[model samples]
Target: MIKVIKPGIQLTIQDLGRVGFRHLGVSRSGSLDTYAHIIANRLVNNHDNDAVLELTVGLCELQFECDTVIALHGADLKATLDGHPLYPGWSYPIKAMQTLKFATGRGGSRAYIAVKGGIECPEVMGSKSTDLGAAIGGFNGRALQSDDIIKITPYAQPWLYNKGALTPPKRKVIRLHQGPHHELLTPECINAFCTTSFTINPNSNRMGVRLDHNNSQIMQHSLSLHSLAVAPGSVQLPPDGNPIVLLNDAQTTGGYPLIGHVIEADLHQFAQFRTADSITFEFVTLEQATAAKSKLDAHLSQLKLSLNRYWAN
Candidate 1:
């Protein structure tokens, strides 16, 4: 078992997410940084779909009730285990009663924690991911709180230790594809959207990230848009003339004008962005977007093969 000493700004259990229910208005609420979540699980010999803890704006504290092996990945959370600094992307053994603490670090906005057998949380709708908006999954369907005891499997497994952490791309350029309503934007606005850099606003969250174009708001010819289906990565231009990028917990439908959709390959990096982070947008064709996804898949496959070889030793 693991106990939450401090829940930090926001902490919740997540898996790949609740899939195939979007048609019914259920959002695919899961870890904002999917790449980190998968890497943490892989390091601990856990399946990619296993439930893990997602820490947003780390300052979390946790204690182990039994001997276990675990892995930490994503943002440099400045995590320490038993007073010793812990590194990301490596599995470590923990003794019973050991305490682990984390502080906010640079480079990213979230972190992920994975145990050997994954977090043993009750699954809802075939997922362990927390849906904060609907309050339907994860631990009590809400953010973790102090004194919350999370169940951990009592099994051990072979995992690589002292492995090198994968370096995530730090490029601020995000590639996107034309959205359904891309035509609504004026020609000048389109040029500005593609060329200008935007800073993330403090209002960003799992639902959506509101962007500030440095006071140069993006304007569209149409002020009103009909409500339509939206998903994670959808970039909507609201009436306020600022673009909002919908995220994991965003509503299924939005009324704002859709200007573009960030490609899936960039979603992980996009999720790590925090307030004041500057990002530039570039448009890509569907072919380019599909190729990018293929490249990501190839990398993941290679990583899995390497981990399997290491475990066999």
Candidate 2:
């Protein structure tokens, strides 16, 4: 069991998210950084879809009721267990009554915490991810609060740990793929979109990220289109002309005009973007996006293979 003494900026339970219900106007609510969440789970030898805690801006404090192995990943939040620093991408064992604390993040916006065998919560609509808009899944379908007792399942497998920690690669440029409506944009507008740098807005969340552009007039001529299916990392331009990148909990459909979609492999990088951080989008071909995704999948597969080998020995 885990006791929440502090809930941080915003902490909630998340997994791969509930899928295939968008036709009914439900959002695909899940972890904003799918890659990091899955990596954290794998580091603890838990199922990739197992429920884990997603902490935004850190500052979460919890106490363990029993000996448990946990893994930390995603953002660098300067987490420590019982006053000892904890590293991302590595699993560490915690004794009973030990306290865990996470300081404010220095480089990222969110962090993932995975315990052995995952957190046991009542699943809703086939997932444990919190859908804040509709108030479903997670701990009563909302961000965690003080005094909440989260049940942790007993670890069935043997206790195992990873020796090394994995950190995300530093990303300065965000890559984008032109959408079907890219041709609808004027040549001048497209040029400005690529040339200018944008800062992430403080109002960003799992639903979408608001980007601050150098000049809003560049999107003055952009027109709204019919509502279409939106996915994570889709850059949409609203009536205000500011670009909002949709995240995991974004609505399935949106009426805003799309500028482009960020490739899947790089979407997790955006999850770490802090307010005021600068980012420039570079357009890439469909082939390039596909190749990048394939490469990432291969790397994940190799990690799984290595994990199996280590456990076998």
Most TM-score-accurate candidate: 1
Summarize candidate 1's per-residue lDDT along 165-280 as a digit string, tens digits. Answer: 58456669999999887776678788888888899999999999888975355463456767999999999987676899999999999888899999999877767888999999
**Candidate 1 backbone collisions, by pair:** none
**TM-score against native, each model:** 0.96, 0.95
Local lDDT at 149 for model 2: 91
For candidate 2, write residues 1-313 as lDDT tens digits.
8999999999999988988888888888888888788888888778999999999999899999877888888887999988999878888888889999999867788899989889898888899999999999999989999999989965534465565446547576888988667888788788888888899999998898898987778766647588888888888877676789999888888887788999987888878999999998899988988998898787778778888777677
Candidate 1 displacement at residue 109 in angstroms: 0.6
**Candidate 2 weakest ten by summed lDDT:** 156-165
- Cα lDDT of candidate 1 equals 0.86
